[model samples]
Target: MRKTKKKNKIYFPDPKFNDSLVTRFVNHLMKNGKKNIAYKIFYNAMKKIDLIKEKEDKTALEIWKEGLKNVMPHVEVRSRRMGGSNIQVPIPISSNSKITKAMKLLISCAFIRNEKTMSNKLAFEIWDAFKEQGEAVKRKENIHKMAEANKAFSHFRF
Candidate 1:
């Protein structure tokens, strides 16, 4: 057991977007340490989003950020073992972990999409999230519902 919390490493922002959030997402999307490929996929998806929403006044980066914001969950459930039984406890999520969860959901949903390319799938997923109607958003809703349903158990939260 450690006495102190671990320190998070500072990440450099992406070159094109200059946002550390994008860097974090690309890092999560990276497979087998192929960070360049991950960055390419993300940038390509952003470009595709721009082309698709040419009529909209919003930029692709703005859309992506909004989408991620929409998918961030405020609460989640955790199982805790009590005296003689285990119970699910509803707990509020930390700001940092909320972003991590949203990014994971987006990437997982994108991977399962029936698109020819990773960029295409990611573009569609992000757009759906922006519109508040995607797997990531749906998952967030489900999590909220579960948290609400288990609100009585919140006292067990650590």
Candidate 2:
């Protein structure tokens, strides 16, 4: 019962890519308020992608975008009370939330990758995602499967 909705904060585009999305991704990647370190890691990962990319037609940033898109989930499941019973309801996600979730998943999967450095791990994760074969992609697929399984309960969406 709030009187007003919270406003979204504005983020300036990153220095290297001039993309607000990149800024948002770095914000998600950031730890302990060390934005400079996060930016360094992200930029380094982009450089690694540039060195190892297979598709010459697309840039590193483009590959990252595609990978993120691949990880974005269209629907998600939530618990809802219906007829004195809890039901898993499938709900459509908004575009902004989809992007946020995708970024978080990508970063988290990158952290779990077996690599020498954060940059290397992130670069490999991005490449794997771009190829549609990575933990992030798998997580997205799992979410889709859950949503599909609970399609009958979609009527309970709030």
Candidate 3:
């Protein structure tokens, strides 16, 4: 297994959006391998967005993409052992990992939100993220703050 690198599995685009990012989000939202349920939740959230969207022109998919973009973190802290003490090293996240992290954060924030259903909660989170005012966005800002605080550890890049 160590002889070669793991190959990336191809992700088919979601039928509704015809977009691979949507498929990726659905994958992260799936639990117990319930892909049907995950797809249902995402589709329902899109419907909610259509109903309550502020702008008259932008589509739900566009808003969702904006939300996802707003949630991405550029820099994050990693713990590094320096001598007997551990230091928090601020490192830049790679492009692929950043997208994955953004999707996961959006899903997690939606789960904790109070709403009648997962779809409704996800819709609310999406709208909040679109406006850059949700927990996911806050998490990203906090990561930047921590990274700034650990600026001295920039030399510890691995």
Candidate 4:
């Protein structure tokens, strides 16, 4: 690699939750340089989740974390070129990468939800993920299944 690896920047936790993960989520959710708007949308979604899942004893943040975990992929397949052929090689994912992938899948799936508002869509997706039955969760499951199916090509992993 030509460039040195960039040092990871430290992110201070958000005001309400005092959690760095929440800040990271909000950062991913941010668009057009509007972080406050992203925070508002996330906080509103959390409030909606609280109201919708009232029977659950856990806080909204806990639910959100659980949802993220549910969508985290343990293994993924990558394209590898070997012996004049391309192969799908299964590989284990690092913990940090799993979290990043889960967050990205959740955000992308939530964006496609058919809801009146972004907050409502995100809240609904989060609730579904917490139940282990959402598009994002399914996507993760599919990724793992594909990796398992391609286990014979694991030797091709670069």
Candidate 5:
């Protein structure tokens, strides 16, 4: 390779959950370098989740992890050009990429939601994902379906 690959930076876990994944999600949720605000929103959402899903045996962090897993897409289609034609090729995604995609989808959907605040919208999205119903989950399902439908093009993967 002409250029060296960039090294991955280590992420410190959030205070409440002490989980690196939560820290990553909060980092993605952060805007304009407002990390404190992001942390507050994420913690508040987790608290709300705990308050609402009292009967579940899982902790709020575990529920959030499940929600993240629910929204993670295993395969995705990418446009590739070959023989003067463009084709949609299904490719497996790495775990980190899957997590990142899920986080982005969740945040985007949360932003579009008609909620009083960003934290509330994010909390609702997290709850819906945990229950296996939400825009983010639907998006993941759609991605999987698309990948399955285009499985015939798997041979075209670069």
Candidate 6:
């Protein structure tokens, strides 16, 4: 390999929660190189979630984490070419990138909602994820389904 594999940089935790996962999620949410806007959207969504949800058993942050867990995909299908034919090969997902994938799905599904503000949409999606039902969770389920359907090609995995 050229110059060995690039080292993984460590990310400092987010200010409010002191959690690196939050920082990673914010990084995924960032656009136009504006990380502050992403943080604002995330924190505001937590606040909105607090106001919208009646139960006080779980904190907003915990609920968000739960939502991310629900949306985490376990397996996926990757395209591979063999014998002059392309196939969808199912494979188990790597643990390290799982959180990033979940974060990306959460942000994308939040954006698809018809809510007035991104915060509200994110809050709703987070709440739905906590309940194990949401676009993001549906997306995870779809990924698993696709992987299962493509299991026949799993041997094609390199």
**Could you estimate the TM-score for every candidate?**
0.95, 0.95, 0.95, 0.94, 0.94, 0.93
Distance from true position, residue 154, model 1, in Å?
Answer: 0.8
lDDT of model 1 at position 16: 93
At residue 1, candidate 4 shows an lDDT of 90
- Candidates 4 and 6 compared by TM-score, better number: 4
Task: Compare candidates 3 and 4 on TM-score and give the better one.
Answer: 3
Model 3 stretches astray by more than 4 angstroms: 1-6
Off by over 4 Å in 1: none
Question: 59-156 in candidate 5: lDDT tens per residue?
Answer: 88888889888888899999998899988899999877888999998898888889898888998898999999989989899999999998999999
The deviation in Å at residue 106 for candidate 6 is 0.7
* Residue lDDT tens for model 1, 1-158: 65787688699999998999999999999999999999999999999999888577999999999999999999999999999998889998888899999999999999999999999999999999999997889989999999999888988878
- What clash pairs does model 3 have? none
Better of 2 and 6 by TM-score: 2
Off by over 4 Å in 5: 1-3
Q: Cα lDDT for residue 131, model 2?
A: 93
lDDT of 4: 0.93
Q: Please, what are the lDDT tens digits per residue for candidate 3 over residues 3-81?
A: 7965776899999889998999999999999999999999999999999986558999999999999999999999999
Error of 5 at 74 (Å): 0.3
Better of 4 and 6 by lDDT: 4
Positional deviation of 80 in candidate 5, in angstroms?
A: 0.7
Report every candidate's CA lDDT: 0.94, 0.95, 0.94, 0.93, 0.89, 0.90
Please state the error at residue 35 of candidate 2 in Å: 0.5
